[model samples]
Target: MLGSAILERRLELEVSQEKLAEMASVHRNYVGKVERGEQNLTIETLVRFAVTFKCKPSELLAEAGL
Candidate 1:
């Protein structure tokens, strides 16, 4: 649920998983896992993603249906 739209948003921004991971300061595999809904991310990771995407955390959460 959370991962799917995160993946979509990344694609909408034309960012690859590796690139998004780099931006978020997380491992590429971590990003992949998140995108695949294999990993449940923490608030810190969500914050990192929000920052990397230049959006509010609430926005990202909403987009991801979290």
Candidate 2:
């Protein structure tokens, strides 16, 4: 599976998957699956992630190619 730009950005900022999950209120494994392009994300979940990154959901979608 292709790695997500979310993963790229997270790594760029030196944030751990667990930490991101904590901040996003998501399961860590869900973040891992998302990073690995294995998750079919809901809008709410995407919003949680976008909020964690302090970015717009559309921007995150563009980055993630959703």
Candidate 3:
């Protein structure tokens, strides 16, 4: 799932949810919801997260099995 993948990558990077949110230019609550599978993400947001994590968006999607 996207949430799991995002959470895993964030942890792998040793960053806090708040830091990830800042890096991705998203709200902290949004990041939390995202990691909890409580939100649907737009492509722009996905790209932001990928950029923050230094990974390709396709890789993130692949991680999510999408």
As for candidate 3, its clashing pairs are none
**Number of the top candidate by TM-score?**
3
| Model 2 C-alpha lDDT per residue in residues 1-66, reported as the tens digit of each score | 223778876887688999988988988788899988888888898888878888898888787565
* Ranking of all predicted structures according to lDDT, beginning with the best and ending with the worst: 3, 1, 2
Better of 2 and 3 by TM-score: 3
Q: What is the C-alpha lDDT profile of model 1 across 5-33, one tens digit per residue?
A: 78887998898899999989999789889
Which 10-residue window of candidate 1 scores lowest in summed lDDT?
57-66
In lDDT terms, which candidate is top? 3
Q: Candidate 2 at 30: error in angstroms?
A: 0.9
**Per-prediction TM-score to the true structure, in the order listed:** 0.90, 0.86, 0.96
Shift of residue 66 alpha carbon in model 2, Å: 4.1
Candidate 3 per-residue lDDT over residues 1-66, each given as its tens digit: 899999999999999999999989999789899989999999999999999989999999999999
